[model samples]
Target: MYKRALPPAHYSLKIQSFSLLSKSNVDKYDSGVFEVGGYKWSLSLYPNGDKDNNGSGFVSFYLSIEETDKLPHGWEVDVNYKLFVYDKIRDVYLTIQDADGAVRSFHDLKTQWGFVDA
Candidate 1:
């Protein structure tokens, strides 16, 4: 599981990737494997906006969570992603802020569409 310094224990999301094509969602995938206090957790990503967005542009994403008590599905409850950003001209650094409000690192992709399964 990937470790992230976020509030609460587990940090998860739904859906994963998209296609950046004409009239296509062009998904930006999020690694489904996440952890909280070292405990394994599940997540999924679902398409929220641009239900039919198939153009080239900055892709948007949100965080959704599901507890172990509930069965996994296409769309879960409790979604969370506090820190986020969208590149205007497309840059090399991926925006990611630490829980302490510090810019430590960045990635090549952004978490846009997907849902986390329980």
Candidate 2:
């Protein structure tokens, strides 16, 4: 697992003001652009969970690849990813991921991947 310096065992993501994340407007929030393995990506938070996937009451986080149009046909990237949530009360990040650490392939047909429930 990847680790950040905030603590010895967990990664950190700081959101300045969480008041902007409302149940009715979660679709508007984004973590903006970031880079990983020379590829562009972004994170999205669904505070109310993804009801369409029967994930209500749990938070939903998604990692999405950006600028897929730049890829050539049949291009694919294999990725191994993990998702985490800071547990303020416990002061630890609640990590969620596949135990097998399977590599997922992203290509022209699929530009994004992540857990619908986390």
Candidate 3:
């Protein structure tokens, strides 16, 4: 994974799972857990709310990694990860490509959402 600048803010992101099966194949997925590169990152997916489909299912997700830092201010970090989805047609994991088809840096993902002095 490589770090790419996004205007001014950036985050560490990479393929955490491949061919993930959630069981519930609703038209959309709203909530679920994501395992990224061996680490479990909580995800909040809002594919459709009650207003749309009686409050159920989702198509996409907004990923947020739990993290904490101590270097003061927003410090840059090293990120190496790959993100992918299961390709049912090929029976294999298909790599999700970004606009440039490269690992994206959404923010400093090296830190955890824990006490800094702990």
Candidate 4:
């Protein structure tokens, strides 16, 4: 992980009243659609962690391709992505990505990539 002043180049999601999500029993939240690299995408956030994925006590984040059914059959996309959390005190973003910066392949079977414990 690393810190940087610049925000994510592709897209960003800001939650103003984040604490209320847990109280309201919101297990997961998906951001509105955004386009990147000629494809639509969105951010999926598990505010209280995704228990099913063993992400308890830690935030789980993922980038999901939107409207995958619209794409051609057997379609695939390779992406190198980073997940960021804004550090209010530091005024920088804590960025996390694959340790080796691997290019993850998103296909019909796998439509998202992210950290289980972000």
Candidate 5:
């Protein structure tokens, strides 16, 4: 984990009136398509935590590849990614990444990667 003044370079998801999600019983919410590294992607947010994945009391966030059907067979993407949460009061971001700083491989078999408790 790290703290910095800059926001995530690849993408960011900001939810206004976030409290309404829990009030409305939205278990999961997916953001619209966004492009990165020539591939389409989206953010999956579990505002009230994903109970199925063992995220009962914490927020679960994930990055999902989109439009994978368009990619070639056996396609894969190597990504060194980081997730961030902005602290409005502090004016900084709390960033989280793999401890080993490894490049994660995304392929047909696995299209999502993220923190179960974010």
Candidate 6:
């Protein structure tokens, strides 16, 4: 079991306008693509949670692979990711992640993974 004392990599996302990300306004919002371990990835935000998953009255976030068309069929990637939300009142980042160092698989069929209860 690989226990990450801290994330091997991290990305900070800033949302300038909260209202613009609401589910009623937009289905989802995607952060610009980034590279981790040489794989293209992005952060997807569902401000109103994922409707299909009963993610309402809460924020939903996901990590997804990009440029899948460039990858070979059946190719998959395993990754460990953490999501953070900044608390203005607390002046700290609230972090949520896999406690046991679980690896999430991203493949052709399922290219994204995340917490809907966030």
Q: Highest lDDT, which number? A: 4
On TM-score, the candidate that comes out on top is 4
Can you write out model 6's per-residue Cα lDDT over 1-117, one digit (the tens) per residue? 566554587777898757655725786888989987778989988888888899987888889899999988789887877887886656898887877758988999999888887
Minimum summed lDDT over a 10-residue window in model 4 is located at 1-10
How do the predictions measure up, each by TM-score? 0.29, 0.77, 0.35, 0.84, 0.83, 0.82
Looking at candidate 2, the ten consecutive residues that score lowest on lDDT are 3-12
Query: Model 5: how far is 49 from its true place, Å?
Result: 1.5
Ranking by TM-score: 4, 5, 6, 2, 3, 1
User: Model 6 — which ten-residue stretch has the worst lDDT?
Assistant: 16-25
Clashes of each: 32, 0, 20, 0, 0, 0
lDDT of each: 0.35, 0.70, 0.39, 0.84, 0.83, 0.83
Which residue ranges in model 5 land beyond 4 Å of their true spot? 1-9
TM-score for candidate 5: 0.83
- Per residue, candidate 5 scores C-alpha lDDT tens digits across 1-118 of 5444544457778877667776777899999999977899998888878899999988888888899999999999877788888866678988877788777789999999987887
Worst 10-residue lDDT window, candidate 5: 1-10
Candidate 2's residue-wise lDDT over 1-118, tens digit each? 6433332222245765544564356553678887666678887777777777777876777777888877677788777778766666678988778778776788877877777767
Q: Over the full model, what C-alpha lDDT does candidate 4 score relative to the true structure?
A: 0.84
* Model 4, position 71: C-alpha lDDT score: 98
User: Tens digit of lDDT per residue, candidate 4, span 4-89?
Assistant: 45444578788877667766788999998999777899998898888999999988888998899999999998777887788666
lDDT tens digits, residue span 1-118, model 3:
4444532332333333323433434333423445444334554433233234344442344444544243336754333333354555678975433445443344465432211110
Candidate ranking (lDDT, best to worst): 4, 5, 6, 2, 3, 1
Preferred candidate (TM-score higher): 2 or 6:
6
Clashes of 1: 32
User: How well does candidate 1 match the true structure in TM-score terms?
Assistant: 0.29
Q: Write the per-residue lDDT of candidate 1 for residues 3-118, one digit (tens) a residue.
A: 54555543433222233332355343344646554333433222233344442233444342224334333432232334333333474435543344432221113223231211
Q: Which candidate model has the greater lDDT, 2 or 4? A: 4
